[model samples]
Target chain A: MKTATFLNRDEFLNHWQGHRKLTRRTIEKFPEEEFFTFSIGGMRTFGELVKELLTISVPGLEGIVNKDDKPFSHDIELADKAAALKMWDEQTEQINELYNKISDEELYETFNLFGQYKDQTNNNLMYFHDNEIHHRAQGFVYLRALGIEPPFFWER
Target chain B: MKTATFLNRDEFLNHWQGHRKLTRRTIEKFPEEEFFTFSIGGMRTFGELVKELLTISVPGLEGIVNKDDKPFSHDIELADKAAALKMWDEQTEQINELYNKISDEELYETFNLFGQYKDQTNNNLMYFHDNEIHHRAQGFVYLRALGIEPPFFWER
Candidate 1:
Protein backbone atom coordinates (compact mmCIF):
# COMPACT_ATOMS: atom_id res chain seq x y z
CA MET A 1 0.00 0.00 0.00
CA LYS A 2 1.16 3.48 -0.78
CA THR A 3 -0.08 6.92 0.13
CA ALA A 4 0.65 10.41 -1.25
CA THR A 5 -0.19 13.86 -0.01
CA PHE A 6 -0.42 16.86 -2.33
CA LEU A 7 -0.97 19.54 0.29
CA ASN A 8 -1.22 19.71 4.06
CA ARG A 9 -4.04 21.22 6.06
CA ASP A 10 -2.25 24.56 6.21
CA GLU A 11 -1.87 24.77 2.43
CA PHE A 12 -5.51 23.87 2.03
CA LEU A 13 -6.40 26.71 4.39
CA ASN A 14 -4.19 29.09 2.44
CA HIS A 15 -5.77 28.06 -0.87
CA TRP A 16 -9.21 28.60 0.61
CA GLN A 17 -8.14 32.01 1.89
CA GLY A 18 -6.84 32.93 -1.55
CA HIS A 19 -10.29 32.31 -2.94
CA ARG A 20 -11.70 34.45 -0.13
CA LYS A 21 -9.36 37.26 -1.06
CA LEU A 22 -10.54 37.06 -4.67
CA THR A 23 -14.19 37.05 -3.57
CA ARG A 24 -13.56 40.15 -1.50
CA ARG A 25 -12.15 41.85 -4.54
CA THR A 26 -15.25 40.89 -6.48
CA ILE A 27 -17.30 42.55 -3.72
CA GLU A 28 -15.23 45.68 -4.03
CA LYS A 29 -15.79 45.80 -7.80
CA PHE A 30 -19.56 45.66 -7.46
CA PRO A 31 -21.60 48.85 -7.59
CA GLU A 32 -23.24 49.59 -4.25
CA GLU A 33 -26.63 50.59 -5.67
CA GLU A 34 -26.91 47.48 -7.82
CA PHE A 35 -25.59 45.17 -5.16
CA PHE A 36 -29.08 44.31 -3.93
CA THR A 37 -31.24 44.77 -6.98
CA PHE A 38 -29.33 43.60 -9.99
CA SER A 39 -29.97 40.19 -11.41
CA ILE A 40 -29.53 38.66 -14.81
CA GLY A 41 -31.63 35.67 -15.84
CA GLY A 42 -33.34 35.66 -12.42
CA MET A 43 -30.21 34.65 -10.55
CA ARG A 44 -29.84 36.02 -7.05
CA THR A 45 -28.22 39.41 -6.86
CA PHE A 46 -24.52 39.39 -5.98
CA GLY A 47 -25.50 40.97 -2.67
CA GLU A 48 -27.71 38.01 -1.83
CA LEU A 49 -24.92 35.61 -2.75
CA VAL A 50 -22.35 37.56 -0.72
CA LYS A 51 -24.71 37.58 2.24
CA GLU A 52 -25.08 33.83 1.97
CA LEU A 53 -21.27 33.40 2.03
CA LEU A 54 -21.08 35.68 5.08
CA THR A 55 -23.73 33.52 6.74
CA ILE A 56 -21.83 30.30 6.18
CA SER A 57 -18.06 30.46 6.88
CA VAL A 58 -17.68 31.42 10.53
CA PRO A 59 -20.90 29.72 11.58
CA GLY A 60 -19.95 26.55 9.78
CA LEU A 61 -16.49 26.43 11.36
CA GLU A 62 -17.93 27.14 14.79
CA GLY A 63 -20.28 24.20 14.29
CA ILE A 64 -17.35 21.92 13.46
CA VAL A 65 -15.10 23.14 16.27
CA ASN A 66 -17.77 23.14 19.01
CA LYS A 67 -19.52 19.96 17.77
CA ASP A 68 -22.81 21.80 17.38
CA ASP A 69 -25.26 21.31 14.57
CA LYS A 70 -27.40 24.17 13.30
CA PRO A 71 -29.54 24.38 10.21
CA PHE A 72 -28.09 26.57 7.46
CA SER A 73 -29.32 30.11 7.04
CA HIS A 74 -28.41 32.92 4.57
CA ASP A 75 -30.54 35.69 6.06
CA ILE A 76 -27.89 38.20 7.04
CA GLU A 77 -28.75 41.86 6.56
CA LEU A 78 -25.77 43.27 4.73
CA ALA A 79 -27.31 46.70 4.16
CA ASP A 80 -24.61 47.65 1.70
CA LYS A 81 -21.31 46.50 0.25
CA ALA A 82 -19.50 48.35 3.04
CA ALA A 83 -21.30 46.32 5.69
CA ALA A 84 -20.70 43.16 3.69
CA LEU A 85 -16.99 43.90 3.32
CA LYS A 86 -16.66 44.56 7.05
CA MET A 87 -18.24 41.21 7.93
CA TRP A 88 -16.20 39.46 5.27
CA ASP A 89 -13.03 40.67 6.95
CA GLU A 90 -14.36 39.59 10.34
CA GLN A 91 -15.25 36.08 9.16
CA THR A 92 -11.84 35.74 7.55
CA GLU A 93 -10.32 36.18 11.00
CA GLN A 94 -12.86 33.89 12.63
CA ILE A 95 -12.05 31.20 10.08
CA ASN A 96 -8.38 31.46 10.96
CA GLU A 97 -9.25 31.14 14.64
CA LEU A 98 -11.74 28.25 14.45
CA TYR A 99 -9.76 26.43 11.79
CA ASN A 100 -6.66 26.17 13.96
CA LYS A 101 -8.60 24.72 16.93
CA ILE A 102 -9.57 21.52 15.07
CA SER A 103 -6.79 18.99 15.53
CA ASP A 104 -5.39 17.07 12.58
CA GLU A 105 -6.95 13.93 14.03
CA GLU A 106 -10.35 15.53 13.55
CA LEU A 107 -9.72 16.33 9.90
CA TYR A 108 -11.39 13.15 8.69
CA GLU A 109 -14.26 13.08 11.16
CA THR A 110 -17.76 13.35 9.77
CA PHE A 111 -19.46 16.43 11.18
CA ASN A 112 -23.03 17.10 10.16
CA LEU A 113 -22.91 20.48 8.42
CA PHE A 114 -25.76 22.85 9.16
CA GLY A 115 -27.40 19.72 10.63
CA GLN A 116 -27.80 18.70 7.02
CA TYR A 117 -24.87 17.76 4.77
CA LYS A 118 -22.69 15.07 6.27
CA ASP A 119 -19.06 14.72 5.26
CA GLN A 120 -15.51 14.71 6.54
CA THR A 121 -14.25 17.96 8.04
CA ASN A 122 -11.91 18.36 5.09
CA ASN A 123 -14.70 18.00 2.53
CA ASN A 124 -16.79 20.58 4.35
CA LEU A 125 -13.88 22.99 4.22
CA MET A 126 -13.51 22.31 0.49
CA TYR A 127 -17.20 23.00 0.14
CA PHE A 128 -16.68 26.42 1.64
CA HIS A 129 -13.88 27.07 -0.80
CA ASP A 130 -15.70 25.68 -3.84
CA ASN A 131 -18.96 27.47 -3.03
CA GLU A 132 -17.17 30.79 -2.88
CA ILE A 133 -15.40 30.16 -6.18
CA HIS A 134 -18.69 29.18 -7.76
CA HIS A 135 -20.47 32.32 -6.65
CA ARG A 136 -17.51 34.57 -7.37
CA ALA A 137 -17.44 33.30 -10.94
CA GLN A 138 -21.07 34.28 -11.30
CA GLY A 139 -20.20 37.68 -9.90
CA PHE A 140 -17.52 37.92 -12.58
CA VAL A 141 -20.17 37.43 -15.22
CA TYR A 142 -22.33 40.03 -13.56
CA LEU A 143 -19.44 42.42 -13.55
CA ARG A 144 -18.74 41.73 -17.20
CA ALA A 145 -22.35 42.30 -18.16
CA LEU A 146 -21.99 45.70 -16.58
CA GLY A 147 -18.95 46.21 -18.84
CA ILE A 148 -16.48 45.92 -15.97
CA GLU A 149 -13.31 43.85 -16.10
CA PRO A 150 -13.09 41.64 -13.05
CA PRO A 151 -9.91 41.19 -11.08
CA PHE A 152 -7.74 38.62 -12.84
CA PHE A 153 -8.65 35.09 -11.88
CA TRP A 154 -4.98 34.06 -11.71
CA GLU A 155 -3.83 36.95 -9.56
CA ARG A 156 -4.78 35.06 -6.42
CA MET B 1 9.40 20.88 9.94
CA LYS B 2 5.96 19.29 10.19
CA THR B 3 4.33 18.20 6.94
CA ALA B 4 0.80 16.91 6.41
CA THR B 5 -0.62 15.27 3.33
CA PHE B 6 -4.31 15.56 2.48
CA LEU B 7 -4.77 13.83 -0.92
CA ASN B 8 -2.63 12.07 -3.47
CA ARG B 9 -2.27 12.56 -7.21
CA ASP B 10 -4.92 9.99 -8.10
CA GLU B 11 -7.51 11.65 -5.84
CA PHE B 12 -6.96 15.02 -7.45
CA LEU B 13 -7.62 13.54 -10.87
CA ASN B 14 -10.77 11.84 -9.59
CA HIS B 15 -12.06 15.08 -8.11
CA TRP B 16 -11.45 16.93 -11.35
CA GLN B 17 -13.26 14.25 -13.35
CA GLY B 18 -16.23 14.57 -11.02
CA HIS B 19 -16.59 18.23 -11.94
CA ARG B 20 -16.41 17.31 -15.62
CA LYS B 21 -19.26 14.86 -15.14
CA LEU B 22 -21.34 17.60 -13.58
CA THR B 23 -20.52 20.02 -16.36
CA ARG B 24 -21.56 17.44 -18.96
CA ARG B 25 -24.88 17.16 -17.20
CA THR B 26 -25.17 20.91 -17.36
CA ILE B 27 -24.73 20.75 -21.12
CA GLU B 28 -27.40 18.04 -21.31
CA LYS B 29 -29.89 20.22 -19.47
CA PHE B 30 -29.40 23.25 -21.67
CA PRO B 31 -31.93 23.91 -24.42
CA GLU B 32 -30.42 23.07 -27.77
CA GLU B 33 -30.86 26.53 -29.26
CA GLU B 34 -29.67 28.26 -26.15
CA PHE B 35 -26.54 26.18 -26.02
CA PHE B 36 -24.90 28.71 -28.28
CA THR B 37 -26.96 31.72 -27.32
CA PHE B 38 -28.19 31.61 -23.72
CA SER B 39 -26.30 33.85 -21.35
CA ILE B 40 -26.91 36.07 -18.35
CA GLY B 41 -25.30 39.40 -17.49
CA GLY B 42 -23.52 39.67 -20.83
CA MET B 43 -21.55 36.59 -20.01
CA ARG B 44 -20.61 34.14 -22.74
CA THR B 45 -23.26 31.55 -23.49
CA PHE B 46 -22.88 28.18 -21.81
CA GLY B 47 -21.92 26.80 -25.24
CA GLU B 48 -19.14 29.29 -25.57
CA LEU B 49 -17.94 28.63 -22.06
CA VAL B 50 -17.96 24.86 -22.62
CA LYS B 51 -15.98 25.31 -25.78
CA GLU B 52 -13.36 27.21 -23.88
CA LEU B 53 -13.09 24.37 -21.38
CA LEU B 54 -12.72 21.96 -24.26
CA THR B 55 -10.06 24.16 -25.71
CA ILE B 56 -7.98 24.17 -22.58
CA SER B 57 -8.04 20.73 -20.97
CA VAL B 58 -6.60 18.21 -23.42
CA PRO B 59 -4.41 20.69 -25.24
CA GLY B 60 -3.14 22.07 -21.98
CA LEU B 61 -2.40 18.57 -20.71
CA GLU B 62 -0.73 17.62 -23.95
CA GLY B 63 1.45 20.67 -23.68
CA ILE B 64 2.55 19.63 -20.23
CA VAL B 65 2.90 15.96 -21.04
CA ASN B 66 4.79 16.33 -24.33
CA LYS B 67 6.55 19.56 -23.39
CA ASP B 68 5.02 21.29 -26.37
CA ASP B 69 3.75 24.81 -25.85
CA LYS B 70 1.13 26.06 -28.26
CA PRO B 71 -0.86 29.24 -27.93
CA PHE B 72 -4.33 28.77 -26.48
CA SER B 73 -7.28 28.77 -28.80
CA HIS B 74 -11.03 28.03 -28.35
CA ASP B 75 -12.03 28.27 -31.98
CA ILE B 76 -13.07 24.63 -32.38
CA GLU B 77 -16.35 24.32 -34.20
CA LEU B 78 -18.81 22.55 -31.97
CA ALA B 79 -21.83 22.63 -34.19
CA ASP B 80 -24.27 21.82 -31.41
CA LYS B 81 -24.57 20.25 -27.98
CA ALA B 82 -24.28 16.75 -29.39
CA ALA B 83 -21.01 17.49 -31.11
CA ALA B 84 -19.78 19.35 -28.07
CA LEU B 85 -20.65 16.48 -25.70
CA LYS B 86 -18.99 13.93 -27.93
CA MET B 87 -15.81 15.95 -28.06
CA TRP B 88 -16.07 16.40 -24.32
CA ASP B 89 -16.13 12.65 -23.75
CA GLU B 90 -13.17 12.23 -26.06
CA GLN B 91 -11.25 14.95 -24.27
CA THR B 92 -12.02 13.38 -20.93
CA GLU B 93 -10.31 10.24 -22.13
CA GLN B 94 -7.39 12.22 -23.45
CA ILE B 95 -7.02 14.02 -20.13
CA ASN B 96 -6.72 10.73 -18.30
CA GLU B 97 -4.03 9.64 -20.70
CA LEU B 98 -2.05 12.87 -20.61
CA TYR B 99 -2.43 13.40 -16.88
CA ASN B 100 -0.89 10.05 -16.05
CA LYS B 101 2.18 10.58 -18.20
CA ILE B 102 3.70 13.24 -16.03
CA SER B 103 5.71 11.72 -13.18
CA ASP B 104 5.26 12.86 -9.57
CA GLU B 105 8.78 14.32 -9.81
CA GLU B 106 7.55 16.70 -12.54
CA LEU B 107 4.45 17.75 -10.66
CA TYR B 108 6.07 20.75 -9.00
CA GLU B 109 8.04 21.96 -12.01
CA THR B 110 6.89 25.13 -13.76
CA PHE B 111 5.74 24.78 -17.38
CA ASN B 112 4.67 27.63 -19.63
CA LEU B 113 0.98 26.95 -20.19
CA PHE B 114 -0.30 27.61 -23.72
CA GLY B 115 2.88 29.57 -24.42
CA GLN B 116 2.02 31.81 -21.48
CA TYR B 117 1.12 31.64 -17.78
CA LYS B 118 3.97 29.79 -16.12
CA ASP B 119 3.27 27.87 -12.93
CA GLN B 120 3.95 24.57 -11.27
CA THR B 121 2.57 21.56 -13.14
CA ASN B 122 0.29 21.00 -10.19
CA ASN B 123 -0.93 24.57 -10.24
CA ASN B 124 -1.68 24.35 -13.97
CA LEU B 125 -3.68 21.22 -13.30
CA MET B 126 -5.51 23.07 -10.57
CA TYR B 127 -6.14 25.92 -12.97
CA PHE B 128 -7.89 23.44 -15.24
CA HIS B 129 -10.04 22.14 -12.42
CA ASP B 130 -10.73 25.57 -10.94
CA ASN B 131 -11.42 27.02 -14.36
CA GLU B 132 -14.07 24.38 -14.98
CA ILE B 133 -15.62 24.91 -11.57
CA HIS B 134 -15.68 28.62 -12.25
CA HIS B 135 -17.38 28.21 -15.62
CA ARG B 136 -19.74 25.49 -14.44
CA ALA B 137 -20.82 27.77 -11.63
CA GLN B 138 -21.62 30.44 -14.12
CA GLY B 139 -23.60 27.81 -15.99
CA PHE B 140 -25.45 27.00 -12.77
CA VAL B 141 -26.56 30.59 -12.54
CA TYR B 142 -27.61 30.49 -16.18
CA LEU B 143 -29.66 27.37 -15.48
CA ARG B 144 -31.41 28.92 -12.47
CA ALA B 145 -32.21 31.99 -14.50
CA LEU B 146 -33.82 29.72 -17.07
CA GLY B 147 -35.96 28.21 -14.27
CA ILE B 148 -34.04 24.98 -14.61
CA GLU B 149 -32.67 23.18 -11.59
CA PRO B 150 -29.03 22.36 -12.20
CA PRO B 151 -27.50 19.04 -11.28
CA PHE B 152 -26.63 19.20 -7.62
CA PHE B 153 -23.19 20.71 -7.11
CA TRP B 154 -22.39 18.04 -4.54
CA GLU B 155 -23.62 15.13 -6.62
CA ARG B 156 -20.38 15.34 -8.56
Candidate 2:
Protein backbone atom coordinates (compact mmCIF):
# COMPACT_ATOMS: atom_id res chain seq x y z
CA MET A 1 0.00 0.00 0.00
CA LYS A 2 1.19 3.49 -0.74
CA THR A 3 1.85 5.86 2.12
CA ALA A 4 -1.39 7.44 3.32
CA THR A 5 -0.90 11.17 3.27
CA PHE A 6 -2.81 14.37 2.42
CA LEU A 7 -0.55 16.04 -0.16
CA ASN A 8 -2.77 17.90 -2.59
CA ARG A 9 -4.84 21.00 -1.89
CA ASP A 10 -8.17 19.49 -2.97
CA GLU A 11 -7.61 16.40 -0.86
CA PHE A 12 -6.89 18.52 2.16
CA LEU A 13 -9.89 20.74 1.49
CA ASN A 14 -12.21 17.77 1.19
CA HIS A 15 -11.26 16.60 4.68
CA TRP A 16 -11.76 20.08 6.02
CA GLN A 17 -15.13 20.36 4.36
CA GLY A 18 -16.17 17.01 5.72
CA HIS A 19 -15.20 18.16 9.20
CA ARG A 20 -17.29 21.33 8.93
CA LYS A 21 -20.26 19.26 7.93
CA LEU A 22 -19.68 16.90 10.84
CA THR A 23 -19.50 19.71 13.39
CA ARG A 24 -22.77 21.11 12.16
CA ARG A 25 -24.28 17.72 12.85
CA THR A 26 -22.95 17.83 16.42
CA ILE A 27 -24.78 21.07 16.97
CA GLU A 28 -28.00 19.44 15.85
CA LYS A 29 -27.67 16.69 18.42
CA PHE A 30 -28.00 19.12 21.28
CA PRO A 31 -31.38 20.26 22.64
CA GLU A 32 -30.00 23.80 22.48
CA GLU A 33 -30.76 24.50 26.12
CA GLU A 34 -28.16 22.19 27.70
CA PHE A 35 -25.89 22.45 24.69
CA PHE A 36 -24.09 25.21 26.56
CA THR A 37 -24.44 23.92 30.10
CA PHE A 38 -21.24 23.75 32.18
CA SER A 39 -20.46 20.41 33.81
CA ILE A 40 -17.01 19.44 35.12
CA GLY A 41 -14.65 21.83 36.82
CA GLY A 42 -12.42 23.65 34.33
CA MET A 43 -14.02 21.77 31.43
CA ARG A 44 -15.98 23.99 29.04
CA THR A 45 -19.75 23.68 28.60
CA PHE A 46 -21.09 22.37 25.29
CA GLY A 47 -22.32 25.82 24.37
CA GLU A 48 -18.99 27.33 25.36
CA LEU A 49 -17.07 24.84 23.25
CA VAL A 50 -19.42 25.54 20.37
CA LYS A 51 -18.73 29.23 20.80
CA GLU A 52 -15.02 28.49 20.39
CA LEU A 53 -15.97 26.71 17.20
CA LEU A 54 -17.52 29.95 15.99
CA THR A 55 -14.82 32.42 17.07
CA ILE A 56 -11.62 30.41 16.61
CA SER A 57 -11.96 29.75 12.91
CA VAL A 58 -12.59 33.28 11.63
CA PRO A 59 -9.84 34.90 13.69
CA GLY A 60 -7.52 31.95 13.40
CA LEU A 61 -8.04 31.77 9.66
CA GLU A 62 -7.72 35.49 9.31
CA GLY A 63 -4.41 35.21 11.14
CA ILE A 64 -3.25 32.30 9.00
CA VAL A 65 -4.27 33.96 5.74
CA ASN A 66 -2.50 37.16 6.75
CA LYS A 67 0.32 35.07 8.24
CA ASP A 68 -0.27 36.73 11.57
CA ASP A 69 -0.92 34.53 14.62
CA LYS A 70 -3.31 36.02 17.11
CA PRO A 71 -5.26 34.50 19.95
CA PHE A 72 -8.82 33.31 19.20
CA SER A 73 -10.75 34.17 22.31
CA HIS A 74 -13.41 31.64 23.31
CA ASP A 75 -16.71 33.12 24.52
CA ILE A 76 -19.62 30.72 25.01
CA GLU A 77 -21.62 32.88 27.35
CA LEU A 78 -24.53 34.21 25.34
CA ALA A 79 -28.18 35.15 25.92
CA ASP A 80 -29.41 32.82 23.18
CA LYS A 81 -28.24 29.88 21.06
CA ALA A 82 -29.52 31.44 17.83
CA ALA A 83 -26.87 34.15 17.94
CA ALA A 84 -24.17 31.60 18.62
CA LEU A 85 -25.52 29.46 15.80
CA LYS A 86 -25.51 32.43 13.46
CA MET A 87 -21.92 33.31 14.36
CA TRP A 88 -20.86 29.72 13.83
CA ASP A 89 -22.45 29.77 10.39
CA GLU A 90 -20.68 32.97 9.44
CA GLN A 91 -17.31 31.66 10.59
CA THR A 92 -17.90 28.54 8.58
CA GLU A 93 -18.14 30.77 5.55
CA GLN A 94 -15.03 32.69 6.60
CA ILE A 95 -13.03 29.51 7.01
CA ASN A 96 -13.64 28.61 3.38
CA GLU A 97 -13.14 32.17 2.18
CA LEU A 98 -9.80 32.74 3.91
CA TYR A 99 -8.80 29.14 3.33
CA ASN A 100 -8.89 29.43 -0.45
CA LYS A 101 -6.88 32.60 -0.18
CA ILE A 102 -3.77 30.75 1.08
CA SER A 103 -0.91 30.04 -1.31
CA ASP A 104 0.85 26.69 -1.52
CA GLU A 105 4.19 28.42 -0.99
CA GLU A 106 2.89 29.71 2.34
CA LEU A 107 1.40 26.42 3.44
CA TYR A 108 4.68 24.92 4.63
CA GLU A 109 6.06 28.05 6.24
CA THR A 110 6.00 28.31 10.04
CA PHE A 111 3.58 30.79 11.61
CA ASN A 112 3.19 31.81 15.24
CA LEU A 113 -0.02 30.72 17.01
CA PHE A 114 -1.22 32.75 20.02
CA GLY A 115 2.37 34.00 20.54
CA GLN A 116 3.57 30.47 21.17
CA TYR A 117 4.42 27.34 19.16
CA LYS A 118 6.11 27.73 15.80
CA ASP A 119 3.25 26.39 13.68
CA GLN A 120 3.45 25.13 10.10
CA THR A 121 0.81 26.75 7.94
CA ASN A 122 -0.35 23.39 6.63
CA ASN A 123 -0.43 21.94 10.14
CA ASN A 124 -2.17 25.07 11.36
CA LEU A 125 -4.69 24.58 8.59
CA MET A 126 -5.12 20.98 9.62
CA TYR A 127 -5.50 22.21 13.18
CA PHE A 128 -8.58 24.03 11.96
CA HIS A 129 -10.25 20.70 11.22
CA ASP A 130 -8.28 18.81 13.85
CA ASN A 131 -9.33 21.17 16.59
CA GLU A 132 -12.96 20.78 15.59
CA ILE A 133 -12.56 17.03 15.58
CA HIS A 134 -11.18 17.26 19.13
CA HIS A 135 -14.01 19.35 20.49
CA ARG A 136 -16.80 17.45 18.71
CA ALA A 137 -15.74 14.30 20.53
CA GLN A 138 -16.68 16.03 23.75
CA GLY A 139 -19.98 16.87 22.11
CA PHE A 140 -20.54 13.17 21.54
CA VAL A 141 -20.03 12.27 25.19
CA TYR A 142 -22.45 14.97 26.18
CA LEU A 143 -25.02 13.53 23.77
CA ARG A 144 -24.70 10.05 25.23
CA ALA A 145 -25.03 11.39 28.75
CA LEU A 146 -28.34 12.90 27.72
CA GLY A 147 -29.32 9.46 26.39
CA ILE A 148 -29.31 10.82 22.86
CA GLU A 149 -27.66 9.04 19.93
CA PRO A 150 -25.15 11.07 17.97
CA PRO A 151 -24.65 10.65 14.23
CA PHE A 152 -22.31 8.13 12.68
CA PHE A 153 -18.67 9.06 13.08
CA TRP A 154 -17.92 8.75 9.36
CA GLU A 155 -21.19 10.04 7.96
CA ARG A 156 -19.56 13.29 7.03
CA MET B 1 -3.68 37.42 38.02
CA LYS B 2 -3.81 33.65 37.55
CA THR B 3 -1.40 31.22 35.98
CA ALA B 4 -2.18 28.93 33.02
CA THR B 5 -0.57 25.59 33.73
CA PHE B 6 -0.17 21.95 32.84
CA LEU B 7 -2.06 19.19 34.59
CA ASN B 8 -0.68 16.86 37.28
CA ARG B 9 -1.49 13.14 37.57
CA ASP B 10 -4.74 13.44 39.50
CA GLU B 11 -5.78 16.46 37.48
CA PHE B 12 -5.05 14.61 34.28
CA LEU B 13 -7.02 11.56 35.42
CA ASN B 14 -10.07 13.65 36.23
CA HIS B 15 -9.79 15.12 32.77
CA TRP B 16 -9.58 11.59 31.36
CA GLN B 17 -12.67 10.48 33.23
CA GLY B 18 -14.40 13.60 32.09
CA HIS B 19 -13.36 12.86 28.50
CA ARG B 20 -14.32 9.20 28.75
CA LYS B 21 -17.77 9.93 30.07
CA LEU B 22 -18.27 12.17 27.08
CA THR B 23 -16.69 9.71 24.63
CA ARG B 24 -19.09 6.93 25.47
CA ARG B 25 -21.88 9.46 24.97
CA THR B 26 -20.51 10.39 21.56
CA ILE B 27 -20.25 6.74 20.54
CA GLU B 28 -23.84 6.13 21.54
CA LYS B 29 -24.91 8.85 19.09
CA PHE B 30 -23.59 7.09 16.02
CA PRO B 31 -24.87 4.13 14.07
CA GLU B 32 -22.35 1.30 14.22
CA GLU B 33 -22.12 0.75 10.45
CA GLU B 34 -20.59 4.12 9.69
CA PHE B 35 -18.34 4.29 12.69
CA PHE B 36 -15.31 3.51 10.51
CA THR B 37 -16.28 5.58 7.52
CA PHE B 38 -13.98 8.41 6.48
CA SER B 39 -16.11 10.84 4.49
CA ILE B 40 -12.89 12.23 3.06
CA GLY B 41 -9.71 10.60 1.82
CA GLY B 42 -6.67 10.40 4.12
CA MET B 43 -8.98 10.85 7.07
CA ARG B 44 -9.52 7.82 9.23
CA THR B 45 -13.12 6.68 9.53
CA PHE B 46 -14.57 7.25 12.95
CA GLY B 47 -14.12 3.52 13.56
CA GLU B 48 -10.47 3.55 12.57
CA LEU B 49 -10.06 6.63 14.69
CA VAL B 50 -11.58 4.87 17.70
CA LYS B 51 -9.19 1.98 17.26
CA GLU B 52 -6.29 4.36 17.20
CA LEU B 53 -7.61 5.88 20.40
CA LEU B 54 -7.81 2.49 22.12
CA THR B 55 -4.30 1.49 21.12
CA ILE B 56 -2.47 4.78 21.73
CA SER B 57 -3.03 5.07 25.47
CA VAL B 58 -1.56 1.88 26.91
CA PRO B 59 1.62 2.20 24.89
CA GLY B 60 1.85 5.88 25.71
CA LEU B 61 1.28 5.28 29.41
CA GLU B 62 3.33 2.11 29.47
CA GLY B 63 6.17 4.17 28.13
CA ILE B 64 5.92 6.17 31.31
CA VAL B 65 4.64 3.41 33.56
CA ASN B 66 7.25 0.84 32.50
CA LYS B 67 9.96 3.16 31.12
CA ASP B 68 9.62 1.59 27.66
CA ASP B 69 8.40 2.79 24.26
CA LYS B 70 6.08 0.24 22.67
CA PRO B 71 4.72 0.51 19.16
CA PHE B 72 1.03 0.11 18.07
CA SER B 73 1.35 -3.63 17.68
CA HIS B 74 -0.06 -5.46 20.63
CA ASP B 75 -2.88 -7.85 21.43
CA ILE B 76 -5.22 -4.88 21.47
CA GLU B 77 -6.13 -2.70 18.52
CA LEU B 78 -7.83 0.60 19.20
CA ALA B 79 -9.97 0.04 16.07
CA ASP B 80 -12.66 -1.98 17.78
CA LYS B 81 -15.04 0.56 19.33
CA ALA B 82 -16.60 -1.83 21.81
CA ALA B 83 -13.23 -3.43 22.30
CA ALA B 84 -11.69 -0.02 22.21
CA LEU B 85 -14.17 1.11 24.81
CA LYS B 86 -13.42 -1.98 26.85
CA MET B 87 -9.71 -1.53 26.32
CA TRP B 88 -10.04 2.15 27.07
CA ASP B 89 -11.73 1.25 30.32
CA GLU B 90 -8.97 -1.26 30.93
CA GLN B 91 -6.30 1.26 29.99
CA THR B 92 -7.84 3.75 32.39
CA GLU B 93 -7.41 1.06 34.97
CA GLN B 94 -3.88 0.54 33.72
CA ILE B 95 -3.35 4.27 34.01
CA ASN B 96 -4.44 4.03 37.61
CA GLU B 97 -2.22 1.01 37.95
CA LEU B 98 0.81 2.85 36.56
CA TYR B 99 0.01 5.93 38.58
CA ASN B 100 0.71 3.92 41.67
CA LYS B 101 3.87 2.43 40.17
CA ILE B 102 5.64 5.63 39.10
CA SER B 103 7.94 7.43 41.48
CA ASP B 104 7.58 11.19 41.90
CA GLU B 105 10.93 11.39 40.09
CA GLU B 106 9.57 9.40 37.14
CA LEU B 107 6.49 11.58 36.92
CA TYR B 108 8.59 14.72 36.61
CA GLU B 109 11.23 13.34 34.19
CA THR B 110 10.98 13.35 30.39
CA PHE B 111 9.48 10.37 28.57
CA ASN B 112 9.53 9.40 24.87
CA LEU B 113 6.22 8.56 23.15
CA PHE B 114 7.08 5.87 20.57
CA GLY B 115 9.48 8.43 19.11
CA GLN B 116 6.47 10.61 18.31
CA TYR B 117 7.56 13.40 20.72
CA LYS B 118 9.35 13.77 23.98
CA ASP B 119 8.25 15.74 27.01
CA GLN B 120 8.11 15.46 30.75
CA THR B 121 6.22 12.36 31.91
CA ASN B 122 3.64 14.76 33.27
CA ASN B 123 3.00 16.27 29.83
CA ASN B 124 3.06 12.91 28.04
CA LEU B 125 0.64 11.64 30.64
CA MET B 126 -1.60 14.58 29.86
CA TYR B 127 -1.21 13.93 26.14
CA PHE B 128 -3.42 10.89 26.64
CA HIS B 129 -6.34 13.11 27.66
CA ASP B 130 -5.60 15.68 24.95
CA ASN B 131 -5.89 12.91 22.38
CA GLU B 132 -9.43 12.14 23.51
CA ILE B 133 -10.50 15.79 23.39
CA HIS B 134 -9.20 16.04 19.85
CA HIS B 135 -11.13 13.08 18.48
CA ARG B 136 -14.41 13.68 20.30
CA ALA B 137 -14.93 16.84 18.27
CA GLN B 138 -15.19 14.69 15.14
CA GLY B 139 -17.96 12.79 16.83
CA PHE B 140 -19.87 16.01 17.37
CA VAL B 141 -19.92 16.78 13.67
CA TYR B 142 -20.98 13.27 12.80
CA LEU B 143 -23.91 13.50 15.18
CA ARG B 144 -25.03 16.77 13.70
CA ALA B 145 -25.02 15.40 10.13
CA LEU B 146 -27.25 12.56 11.24
CA GLY B 147 -29.68 15.19 12.42
CA ILE B 148 -29.37 13.76 15.91
CA GLU B 149 -29.16 16.12 18.84
CA PRO B 150 -26.39 15.02 21.17
CA PRO B 151 -26.54 15.57 24.93
CA PHE B 152 -25.24 18.67 26.67
CA PHE B 153 -21.52 19.32 26.25
CA TRP B 154 -20.94 19.64 30.02
CA GLU B 155 -22.59 16.52 31.42
CA ARG B 156 -19.39 15.10 32.81
The candidate scoring highest on TM-score is: 1
Clashing residue pairs in all predictions, respectively, total 0, 33
How would the docking of model 1 be graded?
A: medium
RMSD of 1: 2.2
lDDT by residue for model 1 over B19-132, one digit each (tens)? Answer: 899999999998897888887656789999999999999989889998998898999888999999999999888988888888876786889989897888877887788889
lDDT of 2 by residue, B56-145 (tens): 776676766766775555344445457656766776677667665767567667777676567666555545555666666656655655
The parts of candidate 2 lying over 4 Å away from their true place are: A1-5, A38-42, B1-156
Which 10 consecutive residues of model 1 chain A have the lowest summed lDDT? A1-10
The per-model lDDT (C-alpha) reads 0.84, 0.63
How would you encode candidate 2's per-residue C-alpha lDDT over A1-156 as one tens digit per residue?
111121245545655667677778878777777866733323567787777777767777788777676776775466666776677677767776787787766665678865564666665565556467777776766676566887776566
